[model samples]
Target: MRTRLAAVAENFGRDLDAAYATIDRLLRRARAEGTGLIALPEACLGGYLSSLGSAEDRGTAETRRQRSGPPALALDGPELRRVQEMARDVVVVLGICEDGGTDRYNTAVALTGDGVLGVHRKVHQPLGENLSYAAGSTFEAFETPVGRIGLQICYDKAFPEAARTAALDGARIIVSISAWPGARTAAAADLAQDRWKKRFDLYDQARALENQVVWVASNQAGTFGSLRFVGSAKVVGPGGDVLADTGVDTGVAAADVDVEAELDAARRAMFNLRDRRPDVYGALVREPAHA
Candidate 1:
């Protein structure tokens, strides 16, 4: 069945109340547009850390003391219930900082009025992100009304194995949420010409193409502290063509696609999964400590 999917490239600051309001607004807009599924930027609940400051001034100690991090909500908290209520009809994927024991995890939740369906804790951390939260170990996918879906946050999209593992686990569509920013030094005057934006776009297409899955990507727009986010949210086809995008602005990127047909056609010609060279790529499984 063909369905409308949406990705939000909108700005979300540290204000939790404002974030919820924004979510409510965007979800309503998506529903109005007949979107079955929608994805929001990473740390959309509260917001990402203030800044990845200089090495000498920043670390785990600094990220902890200076950066208060998110509200640290539980998996089945009141906030999630509120979101579920807002998503009574449509499926929504949202990023949040999860409270797990003594640790806080960079997490995303897939849910509807039925409540939680799937949860994905971010596996990769770039810059000093590892200092703020604990990393997730597994890349798992779960079933939804739209299709088998997987969730990955920001840096997780940079790792090919992240999406590959989800695809191998039967993920037909991957929702990647990010708070990605422009290059620290050589940032382009034009948002479209930004180096980080280019990488962000390239990666979205590459992940969808390599995995032969529908890619719905979302990112934070505008600036958050010192980091200027490159909001190029998009929905990419199995063949790596971008179907819809929000460019570098604050808006929702939505596109309709026949998920099953797209995946089938992309794989029919050349099955990237079927013609695997696992025997030669034995090094992939070896412990990272050895590498």
Candidate 2:
């Protein structure tokens, strides 16, 4: 049973109404295309950080105040409810700045018309991200109508362990949502040539190949504040081949794949999971010794 999956590459901002409108339009298109699952970019509800680095790095007290970060939304808030209504039957995965009482988290959620099926708080915070949000402690795979799926936010994909952990927990598909920006210094004239863009694409392929799972990557497009995004949304097969891609533009990358068949074929020859030597890898869990 082949299922159609779509990964979106489009810009979203602080305006909730505008974001909702974009989401509504995307959902409509996915429905028309008969997409079973759709993945939206990180911070698709509000937006990502206007800039990386710390407030002190930018200088000026007013500049620091301006970088306070995106609106913190509750998991059960009306904002998500609206998305749920729009989702209806499609399994939608997207990111948000979660309001966790005293703390704020960079979170991703998988949902349908029924309600949220799974949630993941980004465990790895890059640059000065920790200043804005608290770190998550685990990578979990949960059951959804689409399949056993896992979620990862920007920066989370940089760590191989993040995706590997989810695969070990039985995830057949991984949706990685990112608001990834291009090189800040000496950037390429063509976004396709950007180093960060290359890294972003490489991570998607490597993670899928290693886990032998379907990979869907979504990212922000165009500019937001001082940051310029790469916008290379794509879908990768278990063999690490790109099934569909939006390139360096705003569009949806859609692919039809029978997830179970692909995984079975990839694992049949060299079953990485079954060949694991857990006893010899004890150092993986040890705390690093700082100089």
Where model 2 places Cα greater than 4 Å from the true spot, the runs are 54-68, 288-291
Where does model 1 exceed 4 Å of error?
Answer: 53-66, 287-291
- Model 1, CA-based lDDT: 0.89
Tens-digit lDDT string for candidate 1 (1-291): 789999999888778889889999998888888999999998888888767644533656435634566677788999889899999889999888898877789899999999899999999987777777889998899999888999999899999999999999999999999999998887899988999999999999999999999999999999987889999899999999999999999999999999999999999999999998898997787888855
Q: Residues 72-145, candidate 2, lDDT per residue (tens digit)?
A: 89999999999999999999999999989878888999999999999999999887677677889989999999
Model 2: weakest 10-residue lDDT segment is 56-65
Cα TM-score per model? 0.95, 0.95
For lDDT, the strongest prediction is 2
Q: lDDT for model 2, please.
A: 0.92
